[model samples]
Target: MASGQWRALAEQFQLICPSGGAPGVGSPGALPGLASCGHWVNVAGLQGWVQALLDQGIPSFRCPRCPESPWLWQELCKLGLFTDEARARLEAQILVQEGATGSYRQCPRCQRLVQRLEPGPLRTPCLPCSQQARRLYCFCWGCGRDWPDTSPHADPRCPLQAALHDAPKIQAPPSSLHGCPSLRACPRCYALLSHTLQGYPSVICPECHCVFCYRCLGLSGGHRLPCQIADRQLVCGREAVTLLPMGAQ
Candidate 1:
């Protein structure tokens, strides 16, 4: 949550990297350190776990044994668990997943990530591109198209409003998320995420680690139980319904 807390947590565990079977060493995986959750983990094992989570589109890095205690980015970096390049890539994915894609878009010319400095107009300028070209380079932040030399106040061709109103729909069947918008902004951190139907209707934001119900978009208390608002109205124009267990009908 905070830098100080992460630093304190990082101090609680000793991470040992493999030294190629040095003297008095047992095995590469034998260097186990007790994590903050009191579970033993090796550097290699933890790395594998983090990779698996990333592969699954789940960005939250928590103790394998305890999902409640999250491993902050700073803590992971301080522990040498991730390289600089890896950390940058992971943070980029987290930003996109956290619903920052709406605000942060790639420059149309150079394709470098850019965002509005003060949010004046939809025609946002890319400083890196401008510096490289020795001239102003702006783009339509709404549609990701090159900004025309016409009036900056109007772009009738931009389809951002239509795209936003017609967001993708979830196709997973038998789940509460079915028929709902595939993409959702986390209620806490506003991180955008698409449910893969690999788990329940509740999800944990990879950015803020906030658990929320994907159906009614309410805070789920760690998803310990079924969503209480499962039967409420949804944005997809269909009443939300929870599928009971196969034998519970």
Candidate 2:
């Protein structure tokens, strides 16, 4: 459904949660709740709208009634619209679309989405896991193995450095992102992202709303010229000089 239509409906009617409770409450009967825009929205309808956006290849998720108000993943979780399973499914679909399954990983313990913000040691802490376990819990970001208790900084056995240095290159020859690292972190927020290689080398981070060139890792406004394709290689005004390393950034 179009966003405008959804917005109209949301503004006119009180939204009922399909799960039958106010947001963050465990009540069993349907209860109305306000969206971030202060408009009432049906939880089920809003979920469907988000799905439609993803299906249409639109990555950003914002309130239909208020486009300027973006929905963070955490907020969606609290609204009970995106359970762990549902969120995982949505993430899988995005990864498939971007051809970047390697760019993201799930926390080994809680299966929460996890990504390295900067080139760093293989051992990474999962906040959800730590919260649940009531202690610091870490796992290898590169190999997806549980972090050994013997070390605090680095994984003794994982070949994380080699994995980062030998990261895969974009394989889409017809696109301008070809030959660039398949994995990238948002230049502004350091959120993990991957390019589909179907359009311009630029992308908007769903997390921070930062528009940047995926190929050069530069803000869109900072680019002096558009990225180009030369000899089946991506040529940007500024080229990425290094891949993410295993050491801390």
Candidate 3:
């Protein structure tokens, strides 16, 4: 990659952190040849790169090769050079590279071994523990703490607990599962009309009120926008459903 392209990608990924000074660091607006060194960065193997920089006395971003020791592994992570385990395998897509966490879970009971398999709620059976205890209960990786009698179950600390059950709730009007509590579709422009019913000849739509005909329920010049019912004479019980819902007489 050319130096400019490397800088561009670094900027895109926010990997380039500008510092005031280092022993041989590049100045702002003046980059060294490191950016375009054409070296492929293995986000997962940044430790190797950090080691190489330290051995070679290169000051790309920070003085990695300084006399004292610095943990460039953490710095590389802070620079966004490493793809997260969840997004590691993301394809060539510009946004997020797809990836998955290796299918494994820790045996909280033993605390010395790892379970190698896709973990599930009350599904991962610790063979040694089950055999030793002579019980059929399995372990759940949810909380990493709670164990169940018959099966695995999600615990309060489980990371997947929120994704499994957390659902967004939209609070609507007291009696209606509909649009805004204070506004309704405009009778003319199809704009939201205030529920308070403004203007004369029925509620005049705030937008293009001239076209509003609440009584006839028509549009501008009675063009009758398709948003509402056309040529309607009576509202039937629907209007009363919204208006006279057994509240104000």
Candidate 4:
């Protein structure tokens, strides 16, 4: 019989099974061992409608094993219907049932031995396999970024990552000097330099070469010239000491 004729026979048998329970057109039903088969078709049919809306045109689909029209199956699979295993099993069952010609037999798809009075178009490809076929990824440690690569499951370590891992680390410039009793500064620029200048153990202004008690200099805080100084000689608080002229003292 044609695939459509086969589906009608199966549907009639399911309705008459008493335990199989009656189902509406496109509705799902539970068979003894293949309880999910009916539900699968129902959902698959619904998904096909959604796909038709997405594709904007109904496309022809065919099952690998059965005579039933694969219109719904084709649309669902094209739109990512059931999972790989589910699709495969559903298709397999339909083929086996129809091919048996009413004799009882185990559905290779459902993997269950049962009596079949009819068969339908049942055959689908693996969705997971299809998805995996299109997958890809990569990691770049040097740039610290991960991205899609042409190869899926490629080597985790790349050339850039290796180089970055092997590169030597560098030290930062020192913020303060060690073993110096007090912090001093440059006499001309007032840049903080040595802690002791001209052998005096107190904060010294980097400019003007004046010395002040650590307290007046705000010892805990970085050394600073008095806020209101003007003249070079007496203008100050602590002054940063610089080498003096021969007679300047």
**Best by lDDT, which number?**
2
Worst 10 residues of 3 by lDDT: 91-100
Q: Give the lDDT of residue 153 in candidate 1.
A: 39
The collision pairs in model 2 are 120-246
Compared with the true structure, the alpha-carbon lDDT of candidate 1 equals: 0.52
lDDT per model vs. reference: 0.52, 0.55, 0.34, 0.33
Per-model TM values vs. the true structure: 0.34, 0.42, 0.22, 0.17
For residues 1-249, could you state the per-residue lDDT of candidate 3 as single tens digits? 244643454444333334423323433433222222222222333434433433333323332222122322223333334344422221112111111112333456753222232234434566546666898535554334536475434343343322221111213434222222232344423454433333233355667764443323444342322232222121121131122111111
lDDT by residue (39-148, candidate 2, tens digit) is 44466555555566567665445565566666544345446456667877776665554433334456777776554423566667776687678887887755566874
**Root-mean-square deviation of every model:** 15.6, 12.7, 20.2, 30.4
lDDT for model 2: 0.55
Candidate 1 residue lDDT tens string, 107-148: 678665563323446676776567777887787755666773
**lDDT of model 2, residue 168:** 66
Candidate 4 similarity to native, TM-score: 0.17
Off by over 4 Å in 3: 1-101, 116-119, 151-249
lDDT of 1 at 127: 62
Count clashing pairs, candidate 4: 14
Instruction: List the candidate 2 regions with Cα displacement exceeding 4 Å.
Output: 1-42, 65-70, 81-88, 99-104, 114-128, 135-151, 155-249
Q: Write the per-residue lDDT of candidate 4 for residues 1-249, one digit (tens) a residue.
A: 355744454454332233333444333443222122332233334333333322432122333124342434334444433565755555454433322222222332332223222232112122233355564222222222333443432333333222322222222223121222232333343444334223333445656555543212322333433222111121122232333322111
Steric collisions counted per model:
4, 1, 7, 14
Better of 3 and 4 by lDDT: 3
